[model samples]
Target: MSDSSALTQKLQQQVLELPPESLPDLEKFIEFLRFKFQPRKPKATAKPALDATHAVRLGGLLQGYDFSPELLKEARREMWRKFYVEAE
Candidate 1:
């Protein structure tokens, strides 16, 4: 017969010859194989649509407002002064 068919026959005989106490472990192994080969469902990804859209629009809105690095740093310090003071 074919090599695969012979191997299958040997495997079946081995399974049949296994002790009763080992059957539970064999059943668990079969279940593990079944679960491993089963098709998986795709997971849904969560996204913040409003925030993403707002960020995209904000980038476009600020595209023409080019400022110096020193000015931007000053603006950031002024905007976060209260938080910085509280941190200290």
Candidate 2:
């Protein structure tokens, strides 16, 4: 008999002795094996702590701008990027 045929026969005998309910999840295992692996996410850099002085400066800067709802949110986001965004 061919090597592959003999191997298949041995594998079939092994499977026949296994409990029907306890078989490994072959599909899920194959899917796991087939998955394209990705690298782990990098840890974010530490943020600078906010202080009373910075708050006062921000308040002073924002007090003069036109503070419409959308503009307010955009300004807040810009301020965060300006003051808190990590330098790569």
Candidate 3:
């Protein structure tokens, strides 16, 4: 007989010799083994595409803000006015 069949016969003989009161515990252990060894299905991981209704509005918070280079330079100068070194 093949090793697998021999092992199966051995398990059958052992189970047959087990007391009736232990059968329920054996059934639960068999279920645990089946769950532990069963093949697992791959999980679906596709993300839903964002439509126009859920799209983010870029620069939405700065609709009326001025970003002119001259204004930016003046602001930077005002911020660092006290840090300027006087030339001797």
Candidate 4:
């Protein structure tokens, strides 16, 4: 027989030698192998349309607050100050 057939026969013999109680676990392993190696279908790339009714209103909460780039920069610097500390 060919090498592939010989290997297949050897695997079959080993599987046959396994106890009946271990069959369920062997079946689960075979299923896992099949699922792991199975070819997968490509997912749809199209996104669903957004509903205008559910759309968020920007700057609605902070309408009365004065927002500035400098304030944001200072807040970020203060928040991340601990991460930039140098070791003595």
Best by lDDT: 3
TM-score of decoy 1: 0.46
The whole-model C-alpha lDDT of candidate 4 against the native structure comes to: 0.88
Model 4, TM vs. native: 0.51
Model 2, 1-88: lDDT tens per residue? Answer: 9999999999889778878675766546656776746565666886667887567444576576687999989988998898776763
lDDT against the true structure, per candidate, is: 0.87, 0.75, 0.90, 0.88
Error of 3 at 32 (Å): 0.5
The candidate with the higher TM-score, 1 or 3, is: 3
Off by over 4 Å in 4: 45-88
Query: What is the RMSD, in Å, between candidate 3 and the native fold over all Cα?
Result: 12.3
The reply for model 3, stretches above 4 Å from the true place, is 46-88
Error of 1 at 86 (Å): 35
How would you encode candidate 4's per-residue C-alpha lDDT over 1-88 as one tens digit per residue?
9999999999999999999999999999999999999999766986667799778878688687766999988888986786677532
Worst 10 residues of 1 by lDDT: 52-61
lDDT of 3 by residue, 54-86 (tens): 899776798788999999999999767755644
Off by over 4 Å in 1: 44-88
Each candidate's number of clashing pairs is: 0, 0, 0, 0
